[model samples]
Target chain A: MRPEIVMLALAVGACTWAFRALPFRFDLTGLTPEGWLSRLLAATGPAAIAALCAVSVLPLVKGAAPPAPLGAGLGAVIGLWVWRRSVVLATLGGALAYGAVFAL
Target chain B: MGEARAQFAQGMVAGLPVVLGYFPIAFSFGVAASRAGFSAAETTAFSLIVYSGAAQFLAVALVAAGTPLLVAGFTLVAMGVRHLAYGPALMKHAGQGRTRRAWIWAFGLTDEVFGVALGDLARGRRFSEAFMAGLGLAAYLAWVSGSWAGALAGGGALAAYPAVEAGLGFMLPALFLALLLSILSRRQMPVILIAAGVTLGVTLAVSATAGILAGMLAGALTGALRRATA
Candidate 1:
């Protein structure tokens, strides 16, 4: 990357680090010690993982006909069900399935 | 100081993937901006100033279409309104920061970045300013790097790779689906479907952006109604 780009990258990296590193503790102070906040944070990783899979279906229908949504939908269901283990698989399955539907 | 550094590190680790993702997107943005007749410096400035992905895409597309700057500016401001929510939601988590500082950081918030930051903050994990900063910094670097890379490669050549292009385009929608699924329950499916239907209908009648906003509103309203009825 060019020097300017490199510098910009460094700045972004720095900003992310700062946000992640804020000093306040997650205060689960009451009866609900593991408060809503804690639960929400915990959900972040799984949510991201699921999103990675869910997004795969989107691309499959982009340039194709509206009926292509059928293939995309089926692919997402199957992909999420069978390849539930892998985010990449989930994504790939959706796209490939949609393509297959269009081809046929 | 020590606490800030530790939090920053945590943020860095958490934000690594986001940073990686931003690089190519930014690179593409840079290329697009440059092709639309912006200088390299101007391209970088856009990223530095109005860094939201969708808005950036719209800006470049509008400029390329020869839309006047005033129109582009208004469109961007309208599109960027969604980001305003980040400030109120995140302010308490950032500790005793001034409104100005919060607003500045709020401008930098993206869906992914906010999702990651807010989730962590809500959990009461001891905030590390450094970790948060590190994560943001990583994403920022990736964007700048990606933009520069895109600028160098030229738009025509980049457009030729259809698969990569399509895959990238799909990323946001896929992410959205995943989010919807995460919150989806058997009881909530109907409400979501209704919202989605309404959104698409509205979008067809108005604009795609309007559809997105309408869908979100409809979805939220349905959820609230269900809660009240239940």
Candidate 2:
């Protein structure tokens, strides 16, 4: 409970909250899906996910660890298989695959 | 009011998987923070407040390395700059829903929550402020509590099970990948591929923060290009 640490947490929280909340300030009430703004916003969702996934997975395969890639590969395969049905199931399948392989 | 309550309850239930996914990672963060000399309370504060998964871990390391608070804060915020897009992007798809409480719920737009919300909306689920409230709160509570448990357990709690640790580490990425698959469309394929490529290339060359911004812009611009030509 050091004073500096508390201050640091508050600062980080404030800055991040501002970043996340910035876009809500705009009025998007009647924006059409066909407009450039709407199109970009639509693209933003998948693109952002793409960027996040790239960054997340980059750490795993970086040093070429055996279990890491193997497990992740299995997870992707099984997850994709389950994906045809549901996201939750795909996630579970992927995680289980990775867990089993990484554990072994 | 009752309908809002029901929607909120539904959101919480839907958030259960995200709750499960986040706990292990937050636990790992707590252990890392402890190992980095953060007291249980400081470690918990990072989760309860900042709530950025990668940034929180980076904060622990940076602060431990004696990096100045200002520099560390700048770096963490820079790393999360991509989040600036999440709110507007989600609202655009949310279809003029009730937003009287967006200011309150928007504070909880963590990456997983954003992904889950985005996916649900893409799949034709209607947006509700109440639902987002329940979703965000559930995930937030899980994160804060998990960090607390990990902090109290200290660093050695999971050392004996390194494999499980690795598995837990992969949870967020797996969830993101699944969500990505869920919303992917033929038209958007190019956007996603280019975004991933630019992100990887820039991340390898410059930094992860630069990569994400570049990727998002590239993907969005590409989408705009297609829209214009169509």
Candidate 3:
């Protein structure tokens, strides 16, 4: 390995370590209003949730090639189906869908 | 001591997915760096120095566009601010240690660490310092190794690895979606929707990374609005 590359890796490692070391000044009050809003957003009704899903799906039927679009659509469907309560699944599904479409 | 060991083990297991995910994305970062007139050494340095995915991508794009380094730096710092959002959640756990230690851990904190730590906290679990260290180390390796892979591949090779590359990129969104869903309650859906909508709109209108900041701002504001009405 080049000395320069080794040094670069060390630098990135140091920075990564540095960022993780920052302190958390706890002002519990920061949670007051913002916390409540996050709760509200998290609990949106099924209609709104469905709308979000629909919005995600729109990327499919609009203007794109079949492979990726199809993959995305299918992934979204699977994501929505597998983890109806999971935003992670949905997002993952979309990303995988896109990847699969492009790759396959 | 037992708690610390368990947390560390858990961190290792949980990080498996991230390691798998980061490889391709980091590789792409390397390739992009090479394409942007970066020497292999410079490409490696970027992953090491900047160490941010989107920020590095955008930085190179900006540089290519003839944007000033200052502009790139400003954009990077602005994007880095998102780390602040993850603060309170992480500090809740790391704060149990000495103030200095807490500060040190906070510096290494990234979305991945915050997500894992946050999830553990939500489950009413407290991580030993070992666990936090384990988590941070796992992500760091993935990022660095992945970056190295990309740099070694040179520019054109990434095109051949597009599937894996894109898949790794998907990990970030997937992980975020999962975390968001886990925490999401019926009450928080509107805030999420509005935030997502605003983020989407802003990204289309402004810079993509800037849109993320704007979206978070919009979400926070809307969250505040909803509370006032409630």
> What TM-score is obtained for chain B in each of the predicted models?
0.67, 0.73, 0.68
TM-score of 3: 0.62
Pick by DockQ: which candidate is best? 2
lDDT of 2 by residue, B1-230 (tens): 99999989988987898898778667867887887899998999889889877678767766886867776666566556557668777877664546767778888888778878887888888889889999999889988998999899887776788776555556556655765676678878998999999999998999776776688778868777675544
Q: Write the per-residue lDDT of candidate 2 for residues A1-104, one digit (tens) a residue.
A: 88878888888888788767766766543576578876775677677678767876787778644656456654664556454545445655565567677765
Best prediction by TM-score: 2
Docking quality band of candidate 1, CAPRI definitions: incorrect
Better of 1 and 2 by DockQ: 2
Candidate 3 per-residue C-alpha lDDT over A1-104 given as tens digits, one digit per residue, 9 for 90 to 100? 44543443354445444434442545332555446644333233222222233333333445533555455635563567465543333545655676777676
Per-prediction fnat = 0.01, 0.59, 0.21
TM-score of each: 0.55, 0.68, 0.62
User: Against the true structure, what is model 3's DockQ?
Assistant: 0.21
Model 1, range B38-132, lDDT digits (tens) per residue?
66765776576556665565556555656545544544443343343344456566555433333234444565677677777777765444555
Give lDDT per model, in order.
0.51, 0.75, 0.54
- Rank by TM-score, highest first: 2, 3, 1
Give the alpha carbon lDDT tens digit for every residue of A1-104 in model 1.
24433443344334332332231222222213244443333233222222222222333445443455455745574457354432223434444454455445
